[model samples]
Target chain A: MFYREAGQFKSTYQTDQAIFPIVQDRWFMALVFIVAFVVIPLVADEYWHQAIIIPFLILALAAIGLNILTGYAGLVSLGTGAFMAVGAYSTYKMSTAFPDLNIIIIFLLSGVFAAMVGMVFGAPSLRIKGFYLAVATLAAQFFILWVFNKVEWFFNYSPSGTITAPPRELFGVLVTGPEASPVARYYVCLVFLVVFAFAAKNMARGRLGRSWMAIRDMDIAAEIIGIRPLQTKLSAFGISSFYCGVAGALYIFCWLGSAETEAFDILNVSFPVLFMVIIGGLGSVLGAILGAAFITLMPIFLTNAPPMIGIHLAADLQKHIEEIILGLMIITFLIVEPAGFNRLWQIAKEKIRKWPFPY
Target chain B: MSAEPTVGRKIGDVILDVANVSLSFGGVRALNGVSFDVNEGEVRAIIGPNGAGKSSMLNCINGFYKPTEGMITFKGESHHQMETYESASQGIARTFQNIALFKGMTTLDNIMTGRNLQMKKNFLWQALYFGPALKEELENREVVEKVIDFLEIESIRKTVVGRLPYGLQKRVELARALAAEPDMLLLDEPMAGMNHEEKEDMCRYILDVNDEFGTTIVLIEHDMSVVMDISDRVVVLDYGEKIADGTPDEVRANQRVVDAYLGVQHD
Candidate 1:
């Protein structure tokens, strides 16, 4: 079974400390990576890459960001969409102003800008908590998007009031824009996603991650134990925003190729990402990826399957059906396994490990 | 043990001094002109009936509640107007009346979090999860492991505090507090909801923490026997006024304390 993680033993601290200590799980991950990087590029067409893979990667990154805030730090934020807009606009401004600069540097630096904005919004958490903090973040969402829309400089004073992704090259290879190859774009996203995912995994298992969880669980107790709540909460905001910012940059640079102030509408994108975290496991890193993939790919399958089966539906009807299905799926997951897809995967693996013995 | 040093001069060496502290919620006076002193390396017990302003005193010290009028000095430095975070930075650690452990985290993770204030690494190292972050994590783990061993919570190190029995949760909370290695440990009813066995366990831990780490303890407790046994000195309150303050034996013998406990008629 792909989920089985049995009979793995550690001989040293480093081996015990390895991110995934189970032999079966390690092999499963390796195989998944091989399929994604090597096989999918060869077999999958442009539609799959654009519609399913790219969106899935970007959503997974954003989910990770949200999970860091809501799940680990126990701070709920409704401003994720706004943070993404910051990344997109910041990247657009940087690239447009300095067309000769490296695109990769712009993506990373844009994340810092988002981090600063997130920190400012996250300041209210020091004074407020729970539903109040959520409202404060919502303020950030509206305020940031409002600035992006109203401020002419944010869009380079363009008459369209929208920023377009400029054609960019990485190491003499076209990595973005219409002329860029799908394989190259996919590779870029894959490399960043894998590296950051691993980094996040390690961080969550370390001291700082523990601090976030502690604050989430009980701020009073965390404080008595010498944890500075403001510092820890702010740091969670900063790191989570960093991840979301990078994803936002990639959304315009690698996938969407353009952005608008309305690009981060609260309902269409933000709620879906929140659903990903809730349906994935709240506190587990793997759950973020699982939740992102499930939410990202399901609608694609739903949209394409009916048309292929000689049942044609209008565009509006298809969109409505997708929303309904998404809503129902969210409710079902919340009821059946509030811990999210990670718990489901765990249960499946547990059953498989005890195969032929019905326990 | 060496002859107990004269307790007189040292009594004046107050680690925490609350003077003329008064807090009111509209017409209700939670604390009114309350005054007290806590000395270094001493187990100071604050005992009173319900609504006697014991908790308000702790809240003021920890910066949870700002007293309407008064000053609190810790280590000769006034902190009557300090923020909670600032109080923490100034080396104050405290537990709540109710068990406030992080429910979703394991005992180990909860305790490691206590070391948050001590960690000096920045976001760059934390995000990289290499270099100083790794070193810091390992170092903190060593200290956390020691706490786990001290508390005898090794078996349940990985178990979430929420799922543990009440006594274990309380112990884990203490472990988390001790993980901070604080100069002063404020325990609000550390043994509030425990059975005899659990109370005994908690009492032993409190003493060990005091004796081994030399941590100053200021506790609010309801049990007279536990307070008499563990506290170096006792402060008795009645209606937010300091009714009695002295060694446990001395306070127990005080007429006001006797009246507050038994009855005015008995006194």
Candidate 2:
């Protein structure tokens, strides 16, 4: 009943076009802010921060990136893992080359690098579409990883054939390397998530967002209507890669501490991010985060739940079962509600709007 | 027809002139040496039987299909072939025969996209979505709402065009075109599948657009009554050729056009 918007009347287009137009939605968002910033840090344990929450936030950012391209822009990309590596490796090089520079600036600059690479790969989209385009991006996935793996310069000539994120500080707080506390890293990831999430939402609802959706829905019509297909599609690639690149940097510096190319393997990073977008909901910022949370926590739940119930299974067997269940869930969601968890949430809200009666 | 005078409305000099245009696909000719001109602020109609290349003519005009030969002059700038997006940049907008709307978006958003050319904020400002970006968005929304009100589609502004009925979808497509504030509008089969009431409503909207905005209209329609009533002039095409071009009454009386619509006796 409290979810109703019966009394609110928008007197101006500004109020009507506000992200959260309803008063209730604005209050709910404020409450969520307080919980994320204040309550979670106070109540949650270190394991939750380290093993679950931090990774969830970072992956959510990556999912947002994919959602922008594949979801909003109607372009398919399977090279997210490689795009993330672009961010991680570039950050590695930058932090080492300019040790005194702030990590935040490094992250932003790393994103720009990834955006450029993304545009290079995205050039083929102008000539190809659908499965052909997916294949093209898949080539990007393999090609980018191969380049990073082969090039000694990318890893700073590390014998291990990996890039390690050097310790970095943001405003005097240690937020990277082994010495950084889980809370500090969590805060860093959280700040990036909140700010980018806001920005993503802004882009999704504005003119650029409309153009992306236009290209996705009907390219011929979009072209006839004057939306430049090349520019719009490239922008999606550039922006999406920018987001994934930042997330990748955060993945190494804020969460993983150190990583090999294997950490960004297609099965490991790319597929999971794609699954999160599909299961969470495409074309929705909140959906991207929700999907990331679901995919991130499911594995942890599978490993812990059975042992707690005194029904312990072999580790490998548990892993296989988790994969099967995830596969099944994806199939079911595709058939049942392809819009993913976001649509479910929307339906629930719609129900709440008409609570205590079915009409 | 209702007694609406043309005293204040001025039909000015030629806005679009198609000179000796021909289009072909492989060995098949679609439009063969068809030529016509549209005056500013007048409703012009192109009518023909099925397979008469009426739509092909529209496609050529809007730069979707480059003519194999001939020149199209819009606002006195002549070109051998026009680019697809160049039409919009040059103040020409159109709807498709198949109702090509952005199905995933709401009616309002679809229309708002028409104002994309007018919106000046860059992507950086769009990302921030505050200060100037928000101000620009609101200003554009006001304009879109005016279009929504004009088309009497306010009730369905938030409804996705994909789920709307066929007639409403057609109206939304028209609204999207009008959102551009085009100097000329090209409508292909606007009232093709509508019932009598819906067709009446569409005719009223099309006439209002021409009357109020002074937008030059070049429409390809099948309804002969509607063509004869609203169009200031009509051009008839038959089997990839121009059969007749004159005022609606004059074309209706032409012997070749009568033969094109009704069968001609073999010699």
Candidate 3:
């Protein structure tokens, strides 16, 4: 009943076109912002900040990126982990090269490098589609990680084949490396996620977003209507990669603190991120974050809740059970609601609009 | 007799000329030696049998398919085949035989995408969606809204095209094409599968589009009555060849067209 838009009429195109046209939605969003920025920072402990909140924000960012390509643009990509690695490694090289430069700038610049690589892989989508396109991106995944693994320059010639995020300060608050507090790292990840998510929402609602959807829904019609397929597909790839790159940088600098190629392998970073995109809902920024939350918390819930129930299981068995449940959940979601959590949320909103009486 | 008056609108010179066009896919011929011209501000129709290559001719005109042999001159520029974007940029828009709307998007967005060529703001502006980008989007939305209003689809503005009924889906497709504000429109069997009421509505819209906007129209239709009523001139195709080309009355009386349509016996 509270989600009604009955009296809040839009007076102009600008008002009508506003992302949250309904007053209730805007208010809800404001409440969410308050809780995320103010309440969480004030109350959350180190474990919550480090293990759950920070990773969720960063993975949500990455999921949004993949959603751009796979969901909106209709390009199936399996190389999200690689794109994130591009961000992580490029940020590593840039920060190490210029220690005095702002770490935030390094993060953004790393995204640019990832965007370039993404566009290169995205070119095959013009001639190929569906599973073929996914295979092409899979090639990107393996190739990018392999490059980072073999090339000493990428890891800054580290003896251990691992790159660690050096300590960095933002506005004199330590935000990275061993000495940085979890609170500082949490704030940094939160701010980056908020800004990038806002930008992603903006682009997805604009002409660029329309072009991507047009390409996704009907490429031939899109091409005939003057939307260049090559440019649109590449832009989706580039922007998606840019977001992933930033997320990768955050994954390393703010969350992981240190990473090797193993961290970004197909099974680890790529599949999990893809799962987040799928479970969250394709083509929705909110879905990406929701999917990230669900995926991130599911394992934590599994690991902790079992002990309380006196159902003691081996760590390895728990891990296997988690995989089985995740697989089953993916299948269930695909069969029941291919649109995932976003569509369900929309359905709920629609139901709320007609509450107390069936329409 | 023309149903609508030509007041304030004169059928000018030929804007599109397809001269001896032939298209072949491997050894199978889709179109063979077909030639036609569309006069500016005139409703030109291409009526043919099922395999007579009507869609192929429309496809060839809009640069969806390259003709194997012939030159297509649009606004005096001649080419073997027009590129898709080039044709779109040149103010040529078309509706498909099957509804080809973006099913996932709302009706408003599907129409808004028709303004893709017109939206010139850069990605940075789009990413931010402020100032120039927002202004451009609202401006284009106005244009798209006018189209939605013209088609009388204001009620279903937010409804996804996939869920719309067949007749409304066709109307939405027309809205998308009209959103481009093209100089010429190539409609392939627009009235196909529509009920009598829907067909009547479609015919009125087509006549209005041509009369109000002065857009040259080249359409392919199976309905003989519709072809006769709105078309300024009709071209009949048979076995990928142009057998008749004239006004509807003249083409209706042509012996070859009658033979093609009614199917004459062979020796």
Task: Give the winner by lDDT.
Answer: 2
lDDT measured at residue B38 in model 3 versus the true structure, 0 to 100: 89
Error in Å for residue A153 of model 1: 3.4
Model 1 lDDT tens row, B1-267: 111332331333678888989988899888888888888878899998888889888888988888999999998898667666667667778888888888998888888777887788876687687888878877887888899999999999878788999888889888888888887899999999789988888888887787777788999998878888888888888887788899887888888888886354221
Backbone clash numbers for all candidates listed = 1, 0, 0
| Better structure of 1 and 2 per TM-score | 2
The residue pairs found clashing in candidate 3 are: none
Model 3 chain B poorest ten-residue lDDT run: B258-267
As a TM-score, model 2 comes out at 0.98
Against the true structure, what is each candidate's TM-score? 0.91, 0.98, 0.98
Displacement of residue A316 (Cα, Å) in model 1 is 4.7
Q: Model 2 chain A: which ten-residue window has the lowest total lDDT?
A: A162-171
In terms of lDDT, which candidate is stronger, 1 or 2? 2
In Å, residue B141's CA in model 3 sits off its true spot by: 0.8
Instruction: In angstroms, give how far residue A69 of model 2 lies from its true place.
Output: 0.2
Give the CAPRI class of candidate 2: high
lDDT of 1 by residue, A262-292 (tens): 8787885677788888889898788999999
Winner by DockQ: 3
Candidate 3 local lDDT, B166-214, one digit each (tens):
9999999999999999999999899999999999999999988998999
Q: What does TM-score give for chain A of every model?
A: 0.95, 0.98, 0.97
The better candidate by TM-score, 1 or 3, is 3
